[model samples]
Target: MNDHPHQSSSLTAQAGLPSELNQHNRRADDSAWIEVVQHMDSIYADLVHYQVELEEKNSALEDAQLFIQSVISSISDILIVCNINGEIQQVNHALEEIIGKTAEELLDKPISSLFCEQHLSLIAEFPEHIRSGSLIDCQIELISSEQKEIPMAINCCARFDHENRLSGMVVTGRPLGELRKAYSALHQAHEKLKTANLQLIQSEKMASLGRLVAGVAHELNNPISFLYANMHALKNYQQKFKTYIDAVHVNTSHDELQKLRSQLRIDAMMDDINPLVEGSVEGAERVSEIVQNLRKFTTPQEQKKQSFNLILVIKRAISWVLKAAKTSPEVIHNYPAELNIISNEGYVHQILINLIQNAIDAMDHRGQSKLVITVNKNDDSVQLHIHDNGPGIKQQNLVKIFDPFFTTRTVGSGTGLGLYISYGLATEQCQGDLTVSNHKDGGAEFILSLPLEAGK
Candidate 1:
């Protein structure tokens, strides 16, 4: 009975041990399952964040691609991107339209295939030339899809990669037909502008002439009146001499001839005759000179340049301008007796007249107006300085003075083209320069620099 009870206790202990073991195993399993679930949740969170970041990056990449495509499509110049082997890799919309093919169809095409057969040798040399340096305005004929040859002015430059190594060449060109059209339009516009400029110059010249008409008339009247008076006196003297000569020819006695001479006052008439004759000749010469100056000023100048006396032209200009000037400014000339130069004398005369006139106009209403003109010789040029004792050009107006049609004067008093045309004539026609600045003294100074004759 003791052995059986021991066996029962042992069996009971063993069964209780099995139940405790099962409970321990379940707790351990629950802990492991909880750890696995926490790990899975962390991984899912990371994956979600990465997915969002990837979507944003993909959106940015798409935007960049669209921007590039739009730029390529918007270009008007035909653009071709090629590989080192001279095979076209990509092309812009202009190229696509010109070639009459889609981008897909043109891809991988040999660049030389687009050019005419005559230019194949030159086209083959382009890669080597581009590698050395950029080729600019290279004119070649391109073949269209229809086999028509189209002239093109293409510029090529080496295309470099991120590594700074030249990979291929990028070619950009425009059809010559389009370029010719643009050039033709530009030429037409230039022609119109030239015509308008000529008209403006003529109008300004006429206005200047009109302003001086009264002075010119007065100038002519003085000599003409002198001539008239001298001619009338000569006519009376001739009549007296005729009566005395007729008396002598009629075989009058000595006493009678002496009486006739004394009666006619022949000796006195002789003295007056020389004076009248000299005076008439002087008046005639004066009239001739005035007419010549007017003809020179009014006539159309020839294009050919000639050697002329600069001093004489200046004096004549001063005389003409001062005669018509509303203000009687004192002019001081400090120059050599004569300075000869090779240029268009008429243009120079016109320029000096305009300058002198402008100076006179500026000095108008100013008390004791004075003009000082100084000439200096340089290595290759001569400078003529015209300084006026008037209020210097306004600081704001100085820059705009040479601009066409820009003026500060009253509307009808000036055409504003005087200085502009003067500048053009100085620079363009005479191969000289005209510049102005405020003098150190209280005045405005204009400097005209002109090239000297070849040897003198």
Candidate 2:
């Protein structure tokens, strides 16, 4: 022991311990080795289990990345992800198509590089709002490789990491020019559909109006017809009344003689005879005229174009409107003489009827009304300008007046389709132009430029 550099406490034990004590120390050392071996085994098992969990977590992360990349690839609209430092970390297939750059070329580039100098301000202005968790919709113009400018709608939102911290941005871009074109096309289609529906409703209303006008004209024809027939009878009765008056005049000197005569019979015969005969003839003529006009106005004939007298049709139409409004008041016309243009006579007549009657209705329940129809023959066309002294359509609504179902009047009073159908007829059937504008005389003026010669 003295030769050794140091001695363990057990090895340097004073010589007092017996052989039993020495054996006990050996037992203690053995117990320590057993404990150490068992503890090392437990630690090794824990380490192996931890390594398996690590591998599993790494595999899940890789799968998630793959899934995200697949989703971005399927989308046509541009998808971009940029880090918080504004470096573009990821871009999808559509981004290459939009920017004319490959993924390798765009990666690690500044996000602001996508926009030009003019549009970069919008990004700086709105990026803070986006980072604060607010979604934004904006427009940005991107410059392509060949210096082409493309307008796009950019929707932006903040992207966050697993720690709930903002780490990057996700922007979705869609081309605006194509979208705008599509929208315009859809809007036009909707407008056309609306027009068709209005035309149908107007057709139904016009049919009814034709029937009503026919009824009124028919009613007037009867009285006028009778009166015209009895004109000769009225003249005969007038002659007899004159004879009776002369007899009375000659006998005025003898009141007593007159009293002695058949006073009641002579008085009664003179009074009823003249009035009955004269009134019937006058009324019957008016009734006849009204009926004739009504028949011609509502002539329900299939279209067969032939050489027909135009002045006659206009006269028939004007008479129809006038006779229809006999109960209310009179509608005077400045109808021109002998306008002979070849058109579908029935349709032309109907057109004239509508224009004239519409004017009369404008003067509804008024004391006096005036509707002027002036026709001028051009080298190849006949121009008819119909004027009314009623409320005119406003300038803003002038163009829309031709739109179906767009009427300024109250419901059930006017169908907005009158002007529309009239326009269609003038252009389609007559091969003419029909237009309306506010006249300086505080009324609406409708001008119909009809072809002079028949359209074969």
Best by lDDT: 1
Write one digit per residue (lDDT tens) for candidate 1, span 61-108. Answer: 999999999998999999999998899999999987886878898789
Assess candidate 1 and give its lDDT.
Answer: 0.82
List TM-score per model, in order: 0.43, 0.40
Candidate 2: TM-score?
A: 0.40
Best by TM-score: 1
- Per-residue error at 289 for model 1, in Å? 20
lDDT at 398 for candidate 2? 78
TM-score of 1: 0.43
> Model 1, which residues run further than 4 Å from truth?
1-36, 212-456
